[model samples]
Target: MRDTQRTILVFGATGQQGGAVARALLRAQWAVRALVRDPAAPKSIALREAGVELVRGSFADIDVLRAAMKDAYGVFSVVPSSPSGAVTDEEEVRFGTAIADLASESGIAHLVYSSGASVGEKPTGVARFDTKARIEAHIRELPVTATIVRPVIFMEMLVRPGFGLDKGRFTFFLRPNQSMQLIAVDDIGKFVTAIFADKMRFSGETLKIASDTVTGRELETILTEAAGRPIAYARFPDEVLAANPYLRQLAASLDEGPLADHVDLNVMRELNPEILSFRSWLAGSGRKALDEALGTTGLGL
Candidate 1:
């Protein structure tokens, strides 16, 4: 945690969660060594400017990971799931496990893994979420002190095109009365930094992280109030779910209760007091994007 000292090798440094973690670690004065595939990427350049050491590497390369971890205090690892279709579930587990194994074998002090919120004591039978389940189990057997963080659904996704930020209406996986928790991408770093700073409290533990919980109706009210328009929110229609198997399975997971009912929001807030509720996030980091998406080139339904 000291400046000009041990380094923390961060994977996915160019992406949202990784970017947040890298920035937070840099701010805390930790020497960050980012294992980026392309060190010349725009975000990678910005990271270099901020004092993060960029080491060109990919998850699939053992030598690359070894070089990155050669003299690191800890490693922040997160594999990209199916969001971009870059890797399948099997590939995700492979990369995640390989990273942990190499980090431990290299004598890294700590390994902080970022997993999805939906992963729990029991699998939800979804390959995407279950992939983390397998990786988490494997990390437990490693010889490194590790902290596993399970983050809730990202709030940024709600503001994207298909979510109705521009049309004054939105579709999501929530019944009018069912509650769901969400986390801001920025806060993920804050919590993670705090975790890295205090190893004794976080080590040997798996913590669930979330900022706010909302019912579908409550989300509608907040979005409406924030946009100064009547933004209605409702669950995706049955017909719509039937049209997309992925959407249908996701909706079913929530309805079955494990996805929504397992988290303790109060504990998360206690751990990271700076956690921003969904509404607060909307009015802050999301404001400019919302303005562009809704005010200028509106998102067409």
Candidate 2:
């Protein structure tokens, strides 16, 4: 938690979680060392311009990871989850465990891992995100002072095509009367910064991080207000889930429990002042994506 230490080595600096961590650390006046696959990439270049020591690296290469983390104060860890098809469940566990091992061996001070909301101390049946569960377990078994943050579904994902946003409707994992947790990605960084600043309280703690809960009915009202048009909300059709086994299983998991009405949003905004509700984010940071999702016609949600 000491800000005067070497630096915070951030993996996936080009992606959402790591980018948030890097920016927050910089604002806290901590030295930032970011690992990226291509430091020359525009985003990586931008990080460099912002005073981060961008190290060209990939998660698969341990030497690069080691080189980046050498003598660092802490490490912000997040795996590229498999929902995108770029990684398998097995690959995600491998990267997560490997990083924890490396962090332990290198004497990294504090390790904050970005895990998924669906993951808990006990196992859920979903393979797509349960990988985070496995990794969280692995981290706890290690000797490092680590904090695990399990984030709920992103509010930004609401507008994806598969959600039925393109058809003046919204279809999602939640039922019509159910409430589900959601968070803005920008809030992830601020929450993490606060965690890093007070390691004594947060160290070795597992957190289920979310900002708000919305029922399908509430989502309909909010989206309609934002778009200045009617946007009806409905649960995913049985046939649609039947056609897509992964989504069907995912929906079934939510129907079962844990996915809906799981976190306390009132306590969240108290912990972190930047927790933005869906309505506020739409009028603010989410405006561009809201516009695009409103106009989008096809592809995955």
Candidate 3:
């Protein structure tokens, strides 16, 4: 059983990763407190309704962050990166390091930082991922009990509209025979919940998590079975890669190995037995997204 008296300070509670973690912590019976820019926003209100204590503020507000961390047993840190153009790489490093420094200074018991799979000892040269690497490095040096989780590509991204699901085809970075790992967003919560549950085993560890590993051909089979129609799977053509520098760089990363197969599924399953594979995700929480991508349903989840 969890200690209901112990609270967790979760950052980015209204966003995808933070929202998932906050909900999972609540489900596990841990008291959750979140800092949000607008407490009246629909997502923020929903979080409050679900029992998360809301603190009105942004990442730039140091006093608010310090106040929220007060008396919290643990902190879950995730910051926005340059990909969204919301914050620059420098700002991301600052926010991440600031959270760690504050958590350490506040005497928080444990700190869990969510990073990208591509981030590692050496820089990947991708500013977004390298930025996470910098943050991870900074956290390791802090006087804090920190655990870093590097999640692979999200299964949800595969079903998004531009991926060609609407045209009865799937276009991604993997070649037909090449394989990559993927994790459902919900499963991220499950893993983090387990981490928070067993700090002794997970603390000071950097875990790479994924629910399943599949090749392009396997994806086609799974999508075809789920959609009840043939969904051709193909890698982004050279012409498309040439036209988009960002896509080209991502594809190069996949081919060169940072974004390729690396997770140990057996270990991940041991941490969270309910982890969802691509097929299982499509049949459950991922269904509506897939339907919308396939043009079988209207927008707005």
What TM-score against the true fold does each predicted structure earn? 0.92, 0.92, 0.95
Off by over 4 Å in 3: 1-4, 242-245, 298-301
Summed over model 3, clashes come to 0
60-83: candidate 2 lDDT, tens digit per residue: 999888888888988889888787
Q: Write the per-residue lDDT of candidate 1 for residues 100-127, one digit (tens) a residue.
A: 9998899988899999877767767668
Number of backbone collisions per candidate, in order? 0, 0, 0
Query: For each candidate, what is the lDDT?
Result: 0.84, 0.82, 0.89
TM-score winner between 2 and 3, please give it. 3
Q: Output the better candidate (1/2) by lDDT.
A: 1
Best by TM-score: 3
Q: What is the lDDT of residue 153 in candidate 3?
A: 87
Q: Which has the greatest lDDT?
A: 3
Please list the residue runs of candidate 2 whose C-alpha ends up more than 4 Å from where it truly belongs after superposition.
1-6, 296-301
Ranking of all candidate structures by their lDDT, best first: 3, 1, 2
Q: Cα lDDT of model 1 overall?
A: 0.84
